[model samples]
Target: MPFDFPLIATIAAVFLLAGFVKGVIGLGLPTISVGLLSLVMAPAQAAALLIVPSVITNLQQMRPTATLLPLARRLWSMMLGVILGTLAAGGLIAGANAAGAAAALGAALVLYAAIGLIQVRFQVAPRHEAWAAPVVGGLTGMVTAATGVFVLPAVPYLQAIGLEKDALVQALGLSFLVSTLALALTLSGAGVFTWASVLTLVPALAGQVVGQWLRTRIDAVTFRRWFFAGLLALGAFLALRWLLA
Candidate 1:
């Protein structure tokens, strides 16, 4: 499809804003970008637009957390499970169930954030870690492909694990990288990776990389507060949309 000037401009602007937010907070680029893009494009096109930018930002984030291998290793099972779940969901992710699932996911995020504020934490012993990681990973994978609900659950768990802020951010970037590759592969196999979509990655990644670079100058506390606030607002919006329907 040839690009529409107004639509491309809007997508670029929205992505720039999303990139800035993600750069500051280390996440939210995809959720924000996807949500915003849906207003202008089909859902699949929106997702396709996000793939390169998300991957680029994750690669950028991954560089700093290179030494967090131990933590990453520990979380491998869950990550793998997420990949499997995404693969399993396939095109089913585009159905009516997706909207309902997305709304539920939004509600879950609000609840999780609320519980975190209340200091009601899940105890993650070694045994629990073993079980929780894979289960969470699968859920994350399914949600990522479906509507990005996967990150909401995993983010809280990452915080609960006492992973350093940098470590958590890196893990998130890695998670996105892995899951996106899986999605791309699936799309490729299904004959949906058109040349135009592949070409769009260049500009998308350029914007995302710029955002990642801008992140280092932000204050940590301020970044996190804004990050969670954005997530909360997004969750509420999603829930309301569902309720109205």
Candidate 2:
């Protein structure tokens, strides 16, 4: 396939913005980039384009915070669920019926935003992590396979588990990193992921670094306001695409 410079430019721009969002917060690169890029490409292709950058950025976010062993031990069930769910649904991601998946992704985003905006915080006791992890992880994996975004149940579930702010952010990074790996493998198996797309890693990482730098100067509240608002709009756009399709 020829390297279409224009398309590459568009992708870089999208990743740049998406990376900034991640830098400002701790998530959103895959969600925002895949969601927006789908506007110009097929959902599967869009999802593939996000892989390299998402993996690197999430791993970068994950390394700096607390020890990984304990957190991973606690979250193992959920991670297992994520892998299983993703593998099972690989066909849809690799196939042509992305309309439904995109719609589902859109609905999920809107629902996630509504939940966050309403400030509904749930706390699952540590003792309950065993039973709860698999359920939430499984659901998140299923959603991720179909949509390339995995925040809904997992994020809320993490919040409910009562981790402190830094811990929560680190946990998010770890979860996303795991999801990205699972997602990438699933896509590769489905035969949609490509080496060409991996060329995007450098640009994406550059954007992520720039975003992180800028994050140091921004007000958290304002950043969040815009983030959710953007999410709401993106979700609506995706739903509209499905309705029209």
Candidate 3:
């Protein structure tokens, strides 16, 4: 497959921005990259381009070996649900029309932005985690399979679990890692995975370095405000584009 220079350029720019967002917030690489990429390509294609960068960056975030095993044990049920749900919905995005997938992606982004901006929080009792985790994971996986975004109930559920700040970040990384791998498997099975996504790694990592450097100097809260606002607008535009098409 010949690389389209313009499309590649767009991808580079999008991943750079997406990586920067992830560096600061510890998430959003796939969500932002796929959401923006869907503007120019199908959701499945955008998802393909994101697989490599998402996996690498997420692995970087899941650090401090001591914490990983504990977190993994606690979240194993959710992780299992993620894999099952993603595989179940694997063909939905690949089989959908471009416009339909774009609309789904756009709607996911919009819902995510709304949740972030409004700061919606939920509480899951410790005893309920066994049941709650799998359900949330399954829904999140279905969302990822359909739209290539995996933040919705997953992020909210993580926050509600009352993890300490550091634990929350690491947990997020672990959950995202699981989701990315599940999505990758689904994409591969659906014939949407592409080795060409490797080309995006450089720009994505470069942007992440810069964003991490800036994270220490800036107010993440303020930046998050602007980020959600921008995402809200972008999502609205994409959804409306589909509606009016």
Global lDDT of each candidate = 0.67, 0.82, 0.88
lDDT (Cα, tens digit) per residue for candidate 2, span 74-183: 88898898888877776676677778777877888888777766778798988888889998988888888888888969999998998878777878988898788888
Model 2: lDDT of residue 206: 77
Clash count for candidate 3 is 0
Q: Give me the candidate number with maximum TM-score.
A: 3
Candidate 1 on 130-207: residue-level lDDT in tens? 888888878777766666434656766666666667777778877778877766655555554444544455555666
What residue runs in model 3 are displaced by over 4 Å at the alpha carbon?
none
Q: Model 1 off-target regions past 4 Å? A: 64-68, 96-123, 189-191, 194-227, 242-245
The deviation in Å at residue 35 for candidate 1 is 1.2
Candidate with more favorable, higher TM-score: 2 or 3: 3
TM-score of each: 0.79, 0.94, 0.97
Best-to-worst ranking by TM-score: 3, 2, 1
In order, how many clashes per candidate? 0, 2, 0
Per-residue CA lDDT of model 3 for 76-115, tens digit only, reads 9999988899988887778858788889888888888998
Ranked by lDDT, top first: 3, 2, 1
